[model samples]
Target: MENKKEKKQSKGRRKIEINKISKKSSLNVTFSKRRQGLFNKAGEFCVLSGAEMAIITISPGGKTFTFGHPSADAILNRHLTGNSTSGESSTNLVKGFWWDEQSIESLDLEELNQYVESMEVLRKLVALKVDEMEKGSDQSPSDFLAMDSNSLLDAFASSEAENIE
Candidate 1:
């Protein structure tokens, strides 16, 4: 019985005739089962390989089934709009900018944009740290001088003079 069904399915797929719909009684069921199998295979690949995939299928009657990577449209929109998050920073960005600033190799514009944004964030953090150090000296000169008296005192004094002026 199973072999007979398989044979019929093979025949139907090969002939692909508009006139011969695979006995409406079983055709819908077969289509549904096959579609599920395809979806399951896609899910397995995504889980094992960490791949982002989007699948869109249209049934013979024109119904559509779409699946993939958290949300297919969201990923596609991000790629098109050039939005970069710090958490999901692209590897290319890190390699291109920080690894070798002199390299002539071209990077994707979106990835380069992300790199520039990250660099700006780092620059802001460093500036903040410098400001905090200056404020620490202002808050406690003796404490600031404990580490290196002469140099700290000189810097603190200069910093204070600059503030006053």
Candidate 2:
């Protein structure tokens, strides 16, 4: 009697070259897999750090893919308006400006106009604050530091009232 042993096939991960994949089908498959992995990592980060995140990706075929802790549109609007629903610090607010210039260029004319208007309003508010400082207002830097959004708005409103009076 002859004994024959069957060898099992190993199904383990293999290292692949970092070069661009030439085959369309292979490239599509890789993109699909890697995109899911990237989204998963974003979700894990949100869960672990109690932070909110939104990801937007365009596939090679021009299809849009998005993942957000809340919703993509909501997260985007909040970032654009510089409103912090999560009480994040100013550093995180700066980080929200991570959108590429190409994305901004792709916005429609109406949206672009709105962005410009919002920036103008912000600029005017900053100028008002600077004027107040130059006029030697009683409100100190520490007072501004302790002010929340509503209080800051109130401060501005009171300043406007004083100017009117």
Candidate 3:
């Protein structure tokens, strides 16, 4: 006969029931952690799939927290104005860096203006990248890689700062 001893251990993972937490403190803690986890996953999704997302959540206490890939404003505005164009109709819309000439006629004046501004921003960024490449120092991996939303936003911010000064 063989005797087996049950090892004492806490449950590794448990399925959380779909129910509201009765305790305010526990709910708050769970909300905070889960919110962060959700935002982290959203960011990862955006980076991996070249997708954009915006999550606006109001806590039980009424405080609002936002997680936006690229930007909440851009995503929300695109949704509101129905400016989201995809597929072969638009060129590089995913990167927001370029658009096809054929698609230019489809845009309103505001959209055309916005596209022009985006192109200007991209031009400035390219100039900066060229300068960096010329310098051949402190070359970031992003310099040679495809521009993700974060890097693109950073480039925009830097360009805006340069313009301001």
The best candidate in terms of TM-score: 3
**Best-to-worst ranking by lDDT:** 3, 2, 1
Task: Please provide, for model 2 over 42-71, each residue's C-alpha lDDT reduced to its tens digit, 9 standing for 90 to 100.
Answer: 989988987777887776766667777654
Distance from true location, Cα of 131 in model 3, Å: 38
lDDT of model 2 at position 26: 90
Task: Looking at model 3, report the run of 10 residues with the lowest lDDT sum.
Answer: 85-94
Ranking by TM-score: 3, 2, 1
Could you estimate the TM-score for every candidate?
A: 0.35, 0.41, 0.47
Clashing pairs in 2: none
For all candidates in order, the CA lDDT equals: 0.59, 0.70, 0.73
lDDT of 1 by residue, 17-45 (tens): 35545677577667667777987998899
**TM-score comparison, 1 vs 3, better candidate:** 3
Candidate 2 or 1, higher lDDT: 2
Model 2 lDDT at residue 11 = 70
| Candidate 1 Cα lDDT to native | 0.59
| TM-score between candidate 2 and the true structure | 0.41
- Stretches > 4 Å off in candidate 3: 1-14, 86-165
